[model samples]
Target: MSGIEYHVSLVGNDSWEGTRSAPLRTISAAAEMALPGDVITVHEGTYRERINPPCGGESDDNRIVYQAAVGEKVEIKGSEIITNWEKVQGDVWKVILPNSFFKGFNPYANLIQGDWFTPKGRDHHTGAIYLNGNWLVEAAEFNDVIHHEGNTMLWFATVDEQNTMIWANFGNSNPNEELVEINVRQSVFYPKQSGINYITVRGFTMRHAATPWAPPTAEQVALIGTNWSKGWIIENNVISHSRCTGISLGKYGDEWDNAETTTEAYHRTIDRALGNGWNKEQIGHHIVRGNTISHCEMAGIAGSLGACFSVITENIIHDIHVQRSFTGEEMAAIKFHGAIDTLVSNNRIYRSVIGLWFDWMTQGTRVSRNLLYDNYTSDLFVEVNHGPFMVDHNLCLSTDSKDMLLNVSQGGAYVHNLFMGAVSILPDLGRSTPYLRAHSTEIAGHHTLECGDDRLYNNLVIAQKDQNGLSKYDSAAFPVFMDGNVFLNGAKPCIHETAPLEADWFDPSIKFVIEEDSVYLHLTCQMDWKNQKSRKLVTTELLDQTQISKLPYEDTDGKQFRLDTDYLGVARDESNPYPGPFEMIGEGRMVIKVWPHA
Candidate 1:
């Protein structure tokens, strides 16, 4: 049976019965009135309040769906406008507020501290100041705010026992005249309790949250998060301007939050989690799709062990950790720890620190059809994983990426991808990371990393002049499988390839540019390498079994996988396909739109 419908509008009262004509004033009130199978529709205009759903839906079929009304622009934010500012110095302004004004949790009083977070020789706060939707960089101290640099918008805050004081360099603008705001709340739409399941949040423009540093061992809450829940769908939203992570599908709160700093301590975290419902039925399985998440200080999406058996697809995530105000270990567009059987596909990630980071226990995970470009760091990073993982049909065209594929792990299959960057292979004999069983979260075994058993097949590499490619893997600890690969533009091949095709004399002129929400590739390429060396269609039999896990390259259900499809889902030739991500294309002076195709 269909459940009740609750309406929320800005001009409604909390005492009124929630109907279309008599809507409620707050979404939280509507959430309180809602139950399983209930639908809460928020009307247009901004709502400066937090939405904490007390309970959740029972199942996917009967979910508590909270959606913004169609054709109406709804904005949910965690900041408050402040017009009461006094001019302190030239281009600098100050605001003083009572300690009681923060409602018991003052962001100015809280430091941005957690395990693995680097403050860069100074302390930083969780609070932020914004002038007309743009954020100001937090200063390291009061002296930094006093001696403002040219054109740098900076803010500094100090909290005493009774009051909190803030100073900001407005950069030639009047803070009282303009729309200036400050961070007040920690998060916008986050459930306070763990194990909240089957909730759907969609179509709202959420912004300006004071989220903290989200470590793997902590109760990683963010601007929007599942909080160790299951089967949550966060879709079709514009989430931005977070002090840290934007969306967190991560671990729950316990005594171990920020307490487990070392690797051995983290293994104990995993062991305790395994005993307390860290399985397929209880955790992970969250779907974050079709959202534009940007301007977060930390990751766009972060998960420790709560992102398993999930699908992250069709999202546009960028500008994550781009400001570089500080340093940290966990900074990426999408960062996860144990991404077992997770499918990360069709996502566009760029302009971030790192694109995709599968940290540990990345077994049976599939990374396909993603467009990663112009990242500050590498496009992909796999650390300490004993994987049977697959990364295929991706456009990792980042000439600025020092190492496009930083595979510090082993047993990975890279197929049909176009790379415009270098590769790095490094062994990890320090930390013994775990690898899970096929399609399950149960820990099968653990070992230190071996930088070998990698398969680079049917791929194209166009590196910069004098840039290194797969030659770095020549001294790997174990043997690797390298075949059917073409290197161009001074790119080097591994010594292991029996018959490598190197075309340093020919310039492919590979470059991709964005125009009108489409990525266009411009190149002058050739197909002469096909006759020089035979290319085989990469399949499960060719990938075979990983050395450590002893599992074949297969789908999540243990079915044999096929590499018979290109990045655009075009059919690949079974006998002999072209060496790149494209099977069929023009040869000379080719300019084609290669992304966002139907």
Candidate 2:
């Protein structure tokens, strides 16, 4: 044979020849006997089993590849026992509980019978029977049940929560040495424990228990590696109705530690003092892409700390129904913390607290081409310490109180984004004295902008009427220049400073004193300046630039003429007919000369 091929058959109907007609008994036997580069093929049937790597065994050097038949279906199930009350005392039954525990269970009365612990093994759910931790029980058949025989409980024994399941090494907490991976593709892994890692699960259909103790407690598919394995990939899976995220990467270590003062302290604390915390020492370049995550309690995808350089793209994440008590932590469809070089693009995120949230410390991040619609808060929020960002060409639509698109206190280029349905305008400080200005604001809608320098161009924004024109508190000043823009409805658009004057200028003397939205010019003649009686002649024939005698006003220093008028709210100024900066157009009787003075 090209490589060691081990065949496993759960039905026991096949022969022992290890071929199509004959296969072995269980997957556990195939794993135990198979060497590196071995292919373990299992027949179609439900096999209830658990996989415990040889103690202190590092399987990194050994690659075990397992697959089912091309068109056949196979399911490996765990055991489940149906019981009314659980039999355990002082065992901390009321310990770490999900929100569901508080719903029906009473702390003072009635001892609850449930699987408070998950066992060590790769438990699979197939056909009618679902696995509950190495034990086979039908969950889709029976809603409430706890079945366990030959089951091993997997939990943290010490007072330290991070001290849960040790990886490959016996006592050493290094991630690379004890990396455990569970690869389940085109299969089901339900009712799993919290402490799982280095898992590559793709193209699988997973279902949750009707009444399990809690959701998958730990990271569903944790791709954790300490200075050893750098990353893992979980792509193209249909995950829904889990208590937690469809796929979780990295580790969220314990919050408290007393290792600094104790003689015998946990390694997690020692690592924390040494510039690492719990699973924080592990570095993973995890990629979760092209997955459909919906109907979850929290966001569709979430990354914490050690999750760096991960790209989440082209995923349709919708219907994230978060409760009011989700608090500050539960806000975005995709939430990232302490992440670097992360790119979130070509995704649709809608109807969440915030569409895409960048939290903690993020650098070298890019958020582009995302369609965020009808979110309750700001569609895109870059919070805390995040910098060197490039966000562009995203469409954000919202009726919420915050901006449709927004950036806060961070440095980046915000441009070419269409803001509709009451979006806030980005602050324009492009020409402020000293350093170049930055445009910081959350954006909703689709338009493209330059990367380093923030410039908004070619964006179509349909906004509700700003009844007050513009807010007075906004102090940033910009000259009103209309170009390449179209405004609809009978709405008025004005800049942040004082409102535009609605009245007309009457006197040439007042034109210079008062600021007009439009430029004004005052023209005068030599005859009018010398002879005071000729002032009326200049005012009446101001439309006739050819008729008025040309002379320089004192203010013009003998080169230009100034207009004059005081009786009525009108000004008449003479201009050069030979074409100066100002041109007077109109003729005799009904003549009206308009001057555009530069």
The sequence of per-residue lDDT tens digits that candidate 2 reaches over residues 1-598 is 2357777776543336465456778666655565545666776655544332221111323344455655555544222222222222221111222323223322112211111222223221211111121211222111112222233222211113221111111122222222222211211242132222333334433333111111111222211111112344555554554333444543333344211322122222223422532232234455566666664444566655445555667666665535322232433677665445566766766666678877534444567556666677768765543243445456555545366555432333333343454533344222111111111111111111111112222223334434221221133222221111112222223342132221121111211111342222233211211221211122112211110111111110112212232111133342211111112234222211211111
The digit string of per-residue lDDT tens for model 1 on 258-303 reads 7747998789879988887899989887889999999999899999
Clashes of 1: 0
The candidate that wins on lDDT is 1
Q: What CA RMSD would you report for each candidate? A: 1.3, 22.9
Report how far off residue 212 is in candidate 1 (Å): 1.0
> Could you estimate the TM-score for every candidate?
0.98, 0.46
- C-alpha lDDT score of every prediction, in listed order: 0.89, 0.36
How many clashing residue pairs appear in each of the predictions shown? 0, 37
State the weakest 10-residue window (summed lDDT) of model 1.
525-534
